[model samples]
Target: MEYEKQTEHKHHHVGYGTLILIWVALIALTSITVTIAGISLGSYTLFVALFIAAIKSSLVINIFMHIKFDEPIFKVFLIVSGFTLIVIFILTFSDFIYRG
Candidate 1:
């Protein structure tokens, strides 16, 4: 019996230009977060910083980590993990606030 060889599927390649663009955007977001930290936004400062950080993380994970091309289950797991993290952060913050 002869065994058939399976053909490999070609994966999508991200161009250097696309990577550079993402890097630039990440840098810009970092700068904006730092600038925001300097100004007095009261309690909103943490929220703004975390929001920017989340955007940066999403870009890094989806583009750099190739999560965008991954399977649907991976995306679903990512969402679930993110939701769990948010819940944990909220609980921790709430506990700290209540304790103080």
Candidate 2:
């Protein structure tokens, strides 16, 4: 019996323009985060910073890290990790709230 040869597939490449755009977006978000930090938003400051950080991280992971083009397992792992982080944050906040 003859075995069939597997063909190599080419992966999609991200253009420099797209990378530059993402870089600019990340810079803008960083600036916004810094500006928000300078102002007194009371208890919402951390939340706002974390929210911006989450966005920046997502962009980096999906684009720069090529997670967007990776397999479904990678995407599933990303979601699971994000969910775990959320749970950890919630538990930490709850502990802080319950502390005397």
Top lDDT: which candidate number?
Answer: 2
The TM-score measured for candidate 2 stands at 0.86
Candidate 1 — what's its lDDT?
0.85
Q: Quote the lDDT for 2 in model 2.
A: 21
Q: Give the deviation of candidate 1 from the true structure as CA RMSD.
A: 4.4
Q: What is the lDDT of candidate 2?
A: 0.86
lDDT agreement with native, every candidate: 0.85, 0.86
**lDDT string, candidate 2, 1-100, tens digits:** 1211211121246778899999999999999999999999998999999999999999999888877876679899999999999999999999987999
Every model's TM-score: 0.83, 0.86
RMSD of 2: 4.4
Candidate 1 local lDDT, 3-96, one digit each (tens): 1221112134677888999999999999999899899998888889999999999999998887786667889999999999999999988987
> Where's the lowest-lDDT run of ten residues in candidate 2?
1-10
